[model samples]
Target: MPRRLTRTLRRWLYIGHRWIGIITCLFFAMWFVSGVVMMYVAFPGLSEKERLAALPDMAWEKVRLSPDAAMAAAGAKTFPRDLRLQMLDDEPVYRLTGWDGQRQTISASDGHGIDGVTLDRALAVARHYPGAADVQSIEMVERDQWSVTARYDPFRPLYQIALNDAAGTRLYVSSRTGEIVLDTSATERVWNWLGSIPHWIYPTVLRKDNALWRQVILWLSGICLVVAVSGIWIGILRVRLRRRYSGGRVTPYRGWMAWHHVTGLFAGVFVLTWMFSGWLSVNPGEVFSSRGPSREMLQRYAGHDAPTVAAVVAVTPSSRAVEARFVWLGGAPLMLLANRQGRKLPSIP
Candidate 1:
């Protein structure tokens, strides 16, 4: 190749590489920072005392009911007005809250006079019921404090509910023991908002809505990959051309460019792999689909014995219900269960 043609090609490659880096810089920075925080932060859990303190503040004359009676009162409220009961710590204190509706606090121990109104009923009524609203379970961490969480159908617009109402107010509850740990409505509001800022960037936002912004990021990354690959090819062509003209003697400038070539040659493969993986993480279905095996298939592969197969299968009906079985495989107690299919599963050694 001629000197002028080589110079032109090099100039184009440099421009492409520089632009791609610049475009992805902001998204890359946000992803890096959020990933670091997620690695260290421990999410809060609930307490018992906090769960007990959430009883209704109504007068005895206005509401005179026991803990069981109060639960019955809340339960009778109807659809969109379904009463949710939660326990705090080991004590049986309940947080009475409405879904797609208002919430209240009631004593689970006595079911007496209303403890207090935690959420506004009118606002809860205005909210739409994307699906059935019912509390399946509640956990207590501290006295009068609890974490009340519920899950709706997958096709439902409402995904799940998590409340940490300890003071009978809007708070954050601990997942372990339905106890209020953080006053989320007050001082912690700013931090909660700040935590969500990273969702606007690359992989996070791409997963939610793959619009023009996401496509642009992908295109820029693809360009970078191509530039990296082209850099290696250019280096090889230069070496071959030099050897043809100069009888196999490589110049110092050619050597420096060769180093750049070799670096790009090796690094290009890893870089492409990273980009592709990142893309898959953002657009999962585009790369792979999920399909369940039939009962016959499972029996054929797993085992023909019904009792043996049932023993081997561990069904996690919900996130809260976890089943563990110990099997002595290779003289080691091997614990097995289905994993979050898409991600890498931990090694059992």
Candidate 2:
């Protein structure tokens, strides 16, 4: 190649590499921080203590009442609304609220309650009761559950009450069995509530919908992947151009360019992998929900008949006992369960 053309190519490569690095630094940092947060802080789980503590300060009662009757009596007398009930481990407990809301523990043996707490009150207490600003309207759906769909003030975080009131005195009912599960405020689980911010990235005061933010992140990630690939190509081109320009004479940038070339070449694969995986992490339903392969396909990949598992746990009461299964793939255990719902239970055999 001509010397002028070779020099021009090198200049363009250097410029492209420099700008891509500069522009993507902030995004890379955000991704890194979010990833770390996700690793260290997991989604909320059932806390037996909190649930037990919320029960009315009554003595333990053991009765032979049906689950339906117990749930109905509890809901009508204590709760401000209807409740849901479920028989967990042969004991009927009010699933007043999900992991997302306050829940209750009812003694199945007797109608007496064991414990309960409102999720909103728990979150508020933990988060310093940062009262929502400008609650335009407060609409109560049930006793403990309400939806405040009004515009909140920019100074305060928008609060959604699935169970309990701001004062932490209301009782939330279970949707299934209609029992009063939690009787408290919305002032606990503050960290779990705050942790959702990165997933949405909406400021505490912002009222805008979160769809746009998610789209922006997805688009930026795609661009980053492209930039990473382009950087590798540019590095390769620089190496070739240098070799062609000074056939025998070692270029001044030999060491630096070599370092850049090797690093980019090796790291490109991992970076692209991370980019694609990260992108999927943000929008997993699009890829995993498609009907393409089956458990048989996975079994073939693993060279063994592996138990199929769902990626997410089903929210319904009946599917609570589901667990994930694993199969050996090239001597490494590959998790067959993709989501929390599909997590397998310990092998019975």
Candidate 3:
């Protein structure tokens, strides 16, 4: 390259890195600190242990309708992808999940389908939790900071309830299924404001628009990656390795510039790799594997159609069983049972 062109390019590189670094470094620092906070405090959501602890033991004696009857009420043409009976606010309700990702709740007592949950029903559901005493209904939220992600879309328009306990517990009950889907304590909420909220750039205002959020993340990380690369290049060009500068120092600059040059020389590669990996986290351009299998792909993987409802009803679960999960293996219908202890009983097919 010509001398003038080389100088121009170097000048632009320095200028670009200097300006972009101001913004990206803040984000970089935020990511680093928030990542540490996230090590101990995770974003709030319902875990399996918490869910089980809140559930009242299965009232098998209250179940007057069969699983098949519940499935029929759920409008399942064939066997559902998943079916389980549990207490829904003191009533035995069968929750059915179809292969297409739709969910329905049916009353095992009267075999009536549950279409919507009233505020009274939501409070009842919240009261089932372990520490729920002064349970107060907050407001119906379509999308909020705690439940803004698409994972909660299936349970849209949730009822926010405050337990008013020592933990300052808050519960999000699904208005559609009448189930407590998420619970967060005051501690979790306060910590996550510094943890996942900033790390993932997941403010409710931004994250609610999934496409815009993804684009913003990709652009921000992409620009930061450029800054990292340019900064490394500039650092390499300025440092003297073979023939040392004044005072036998590898870096001629003094003060903060000297410190920056020395540290960048040692940590530049790691910083570059880190930024590159962070940029790749968004999986730009569908380069990595796409999302989970589509509906058609799932159907193909099933290999066979749903099991006949007759076959499903024919098998009887154990007397001690509180929950039953039905699935097909080797094109054969299988029924897996779980007792009150959450221990699996022998499969009955």
The model with the greater lDDT, 1 or 2, is: 2
Top candidate (lDDT): 3
lDDT (Cα atoms) of all candidates against the true structure: 0.38, 0.44, 0.81
- Provide TM-scores for the models: 0.36, 0.43, 0.90
- By TM-score, the candidates rank as 3, 2, 1
> Which residue pairs come into collision in candidate 3?
none
What order do candidates take by lDDT, descending? Answer: 3, 2, 1
| Model 2 per-residue lDDT tens digits across residues 120-217 | 33333222112322222122243211211121111122222333335443333333333323333444334334443454353433414346555776
Output the number of the TM-score-best candidate. Answer: 3
Error of 2 at 238 (Å): 2.1
- Prediction 1 TM-score vs. true: 0.36
Q: Give the TM-score of candidate 2.
A: 0.43
